[model samples]
Target: MSAYPSHPRATIGRYRNRGAYDFQAIHSVVNAAPVLHLSFIPSETDPFPTIIPLLGQMGSFANPDADPSSEPLDLYIHTHASTRLVKLVASQTEDGEKGLPVCASAALVDGYVLALTPFNHSCNYRSAVLHGYATPVTDEAERLYAMELITNGLIPERWGNSRVPPTKTELQTTGILKVTIESASGKVRAAGAANDKQDLENEGVIGKVWTGVVPLWQTLGEPVSNEHNRVPVPAYLDNWRKEANERGEEYAVETARKKY
Candidate 1:
């Protein structure tokens, strides 16, 4: 689907202009984020929902060749088989086919906007939230596909370079959660500080207070080898690190310069 249908739970109420329902917008933010926050009700008797940080990726195992920007995809999260979330999903799905309900979110702060007043200060960021059903993957082929996707998503080509196939115990202990998203939305703010007209007109305030955006991005540093390592940093990893740093800094700086 090109865009998710607008639902009350996923729609943005404030600053509606910043909200986007397109698949490209939502998927891009989620995939680029370093980690995702997953919120779910632990049990029927629990009054509060619990949130956990997890590494997740969005892709279609059935259609590996599909384009994420235009095609539908599933969210995959890897964890230990005995984790509470995995066990909970297993128990909930035992009676029926539907899995446990969950909400997943991802965010990236592009820059910090400093305004004259603290109330006016804001951040330039991209965020996405999704509502879905989560279930543990059972099929061996699909599980393998998701494992490879998750591993490579962290570091491209590392899966093949380090290992050929997982050991029996390793495979048995690893758990993969497949989330079929029902509703999703993305919101973004990519502009410099928005100062009030009165503040801008006052020389004392304008001259004294520095109002601008401080660009921020995650930088990949030089790779350090562990003890007993025999090989130098491979060309693939070195090249990826250099290019990623450059692209990240460029995007952050460009976003900081944008005017509201």
Candidate 2:
């Protein structure tokens, strides 16, 4: 599909020009983010919603080679089996519905935009929000697929380089939630500082205040080996780290030069 069907809850109200409903835009933001925040109501009487940070990935076990830009995908999150979210999903399944309702969001900041005034300051960022029904994965094969997908998503080829099949106890203790998306959208801002005409024309302000974008990107440090480890940093890890650093720096710098 080109894009997800629009829904009221998923629509962007302010700055609508930045909103993107295309599959590629939403999937790219979700997949590139290192962490996802999931929110849901804990109980009817709690009076507050619960939000938790989690590691998640978007993929399709049925179509392993599918193109994410053009094809639909499911979001998978792994956590301990005994967690409150997992238990709630299980109960929801028994009630004969799709599963527990949830909202997942991910964001990446590319640069800090500094303007003459505090009100004009902003950040260049990409963010995605998704509403879905999260259900526990009962199929062992699918669960294993999701585990490997998430592992490799973090570090390419890490799953194959490390342990093989997980033990029975490990399998039993790990919970995988597959989220079927209901509506999703992405918002992006990749631009330099936007200064008002008044601020730009004021000689005093223009001369005294420094206005520009401070490019920012996550950097991966050198791998610190365990005390008991004998192996050096593997070629795969070192190569991935170098490539990722280069990509991040280049993107941030390029984004900083864009006009708002």
Candidate 3:
């Protein structure tokens, strides 16, 4: 069993329940998802909330020397230099009176859950929410690493395609923020709907209402070659097509259902 430092609010349904606090669970869900919604309160007098689409990079908590820590975990991300959200966060100083801007909440919802029974029915889900503050990456070397993390997060092979790395000038213009998850919580609900025995015995009731598990999954699709392109389809893409074929109509129908 893996352990993670927990915040007061992070404890499960009961402090005694002590839900799974493993870092891998948190990191996996965060990494699997491509986009995240970043929320922050602006420094200005406006009452509106600032929400931005963010690309995330996940890794163990490491210092400048790259020494990983078991107890503490850290993650990084980069965004446009001129983004209003970044500017607002950068303005806060570290005095007791004023500090770096804080993220009230950060969350990732992995899947939807559907509950069937009245008392025991519930949708299955996996989610994590973090309460913490954002720190700006000012050093040149760190900024480059942050960029690498962001690129690799989107696609693992992206770094291998380029022979040359980003120039210092390019790094300076980019804004990178490191969010140290101070306190976090993980929750999962994976149980079937609970219908009373009496309800199940009722005549014709079960037949009238559609009931059963509709398992959900995500899958890759066949790659359509560009009309102007002359090169053969890559082997990796061909493998995906083969896998899709093996899965057949069930997979196709599930993919179609998601579109709507």
- RMSD, every candidate, angstroms: 1.0, 0.8, 6.0
* Alpha carbon deviation, residue 58, candidate 1 (Å): 0.4
Q: After best superposition, candidate 3 residue 227: deviation in angstroms? A: 7.8
Best by lDDT: 2
Q: After superposition, how far is residue 248 of candidate 2 from its true place, in Å?
A: 0.7
Better of 1 and 3 by TM-score: 1
- Tens-place lDDT per residue, model 1, 23-139, is 899888888888999999997897999999999889898899888778878999988999999999898789696899999999999899999999989998999999999998989
The TM-score ranking, best first, is 2, 1, 3
lDDT of each: 0.91, 0.93, 0.57
How many clashes in each candidate?
Answer: 0, 0, 9
| TM-scores, each model vs. reference | 0.97, 0.98, 0.71
lDDT at position 223, candidate 2: 98
Off by more than 4 A, model 2: none
Model 1: worst 10 consecutive residues (lDDT sum): 155-164
TM-score of 1: 0.97
Q: Flag the better candidate by TM-score, 2 or 3.
A: 2
